[model samples]
Target: MRYPSKSALLFIAAGALSTGASAHMGTDLHSHGSFMTGLLHPLGGLDHLLAMLAVGVWSAVSARRAGPALLWGPLAFANMLVLGALLGLRGMGGAVVEPMVAASVLALGLLVLTRQGMNAAASMVLVGGFAVFHGLAHGAELAATGDAVAPVAGMFVTTIALHLSGVALGWSLRAANVWATRATGAAVATSGLALLMQLA
Candidate 1:
């Protein structure tokens, strides 16, 4: 039987630690500590990192207008994500935020495997929605610690970097195997399912 690699298990362990750290920080948003905490928040979580990377990979895999889609899709998602985080911080919603996030991973993976490129406006809408969810997830943690601006900016930069990493990873793999793209999609979808299970 195939098992998750050692690195994968380590990733899971790290994510749990980060989540605990965020929760325990307890609504503090101005300490210099929050900056580093916020910066690592996205990278620490497997769900967040994979989903963000998948956005880029999927964008690149599309047969149509791959360039802008790869760049813009994640950007739109990130912008809206920040907005969602603001809402969460304000206590505007229930704490059951993980479901929505898991759904995004599953949806984005399927979308990449299935959808052809749409017109520019529709494309923006698609990417923007995902970005909002991603941002909100990250943003929700912000209410717990450090200087909001620094941590947020750090996360934003990290988010962009991760997307770019995904794009690069996808592009590199694309050259070697025709199936590489779909494999990434599958990996993403599987990861989402795992996250959902953990959340449950």
Candidate 2:
């Protein structure tokens, strides 16, 4: 696959730097604690959307170059997301969740930008680690309501669907233009950096 040109990289960096400050960290879904609320929560934040998509893209790209087993990265993310959410339900790890969620976006975007591949085990661990923070951020919001099963389940299903969609996109991009995938990664990475700045 071809690498992104220096100019392209510079442009992406400039755009990221120019992004307006905004935070979608503490979304309130407590008013209607239903499956739809949980399902839509991931779509509510740019950070969550990009990070989850990046995971799927990374998994697809990695599977093509590495092995089919690497496709399990998304599953690892889903499982860990639930686990982290459970912890969040108990009001644990509230302090650093949002920052970590932002950081996950940055890390996952870089992974896609480079199209890096690791062993399946290592890949799952990395993805799972990032997913925990995402789950924690959302789960913390629901702590007070104490009704987590339906919402968490909805979030879980939506996360998988998003990952699959990303996988399809990544696969198609890889087949048509490798550069497109790289550009997508660059944009995602830029968004991640912008989100981090918002947190900062």
Candidate 3:
């Protein structure tokens, strides 16, 4: 089965993005300091949701060259996220981090859009780099929310779930036709662009 055309994909993306693409969590999850808070924080923002899913989408599409892309990409993101949390605990990041996090959506969406012949090493770096910003955000929140490892673990688990969803979405599209990946990529990238505009 064939998916929608490129134009259709872009149109869909534009519509989605135009409908308020910025990602921000208004709820004060940090004040609670619980594992549930970690699980829910990622879902609070459009940017986090899209970026994490794009990572999984790219990895799933990229696994044809090497299986490492599937595991390594997510691993890099998750570990770096923990590291970012440490930095947050120390109050290392500030306003500068927000734009970086917003930009990550654009970058990952681009990767998904161009999901052909990507270097596994480069992909890891890209995914890991973007993850740092996201991690910092997570860390910044968790640090304020609570001083417990459970929250971190909960956050990690939620991230894994999001990645898996992206992987599933990518593979399902791949099963239909390879071109669908590009469509998916375009959609994700367009969403990122919308988020960037919101930030601006």
**Global Cα lDDT for candidate 1:** 0.61
Model 3 scores a TM of 0.85
Tens-digit per-residue lDDT, 1-200, candidate 1: 34433433343344344333322233343344455666676765566776777777666655354455567776776777667666655654454566767767777666555534565567668767766666666665666663467677677778788778767665654454545445556556666665667677
lDDT of 2 by residue, 17-44 (tens): 4355344533654566778778887777
> Ten residues in a row with the worst lDDT in model 1?
18-27
Could you tell me the C-alpha RMSD of candidate 1 in Å? 5.6
lDDT of each: 0.61, 0.76, 0.72
Q: In model 3, where is the ten-residue run with the lowest total lDDT?
A: 6-15
> What are the per-residue Cα lDDT tens digits for candidate 3 across 131-175?
888888777767766565777777788898988777776666556
For model 3, the superposed segments whose C-alpha errors exceed 4 Å read: 4-21, 65-68
Ranked by lDDT, the better of candidates 1 and 2 is 2
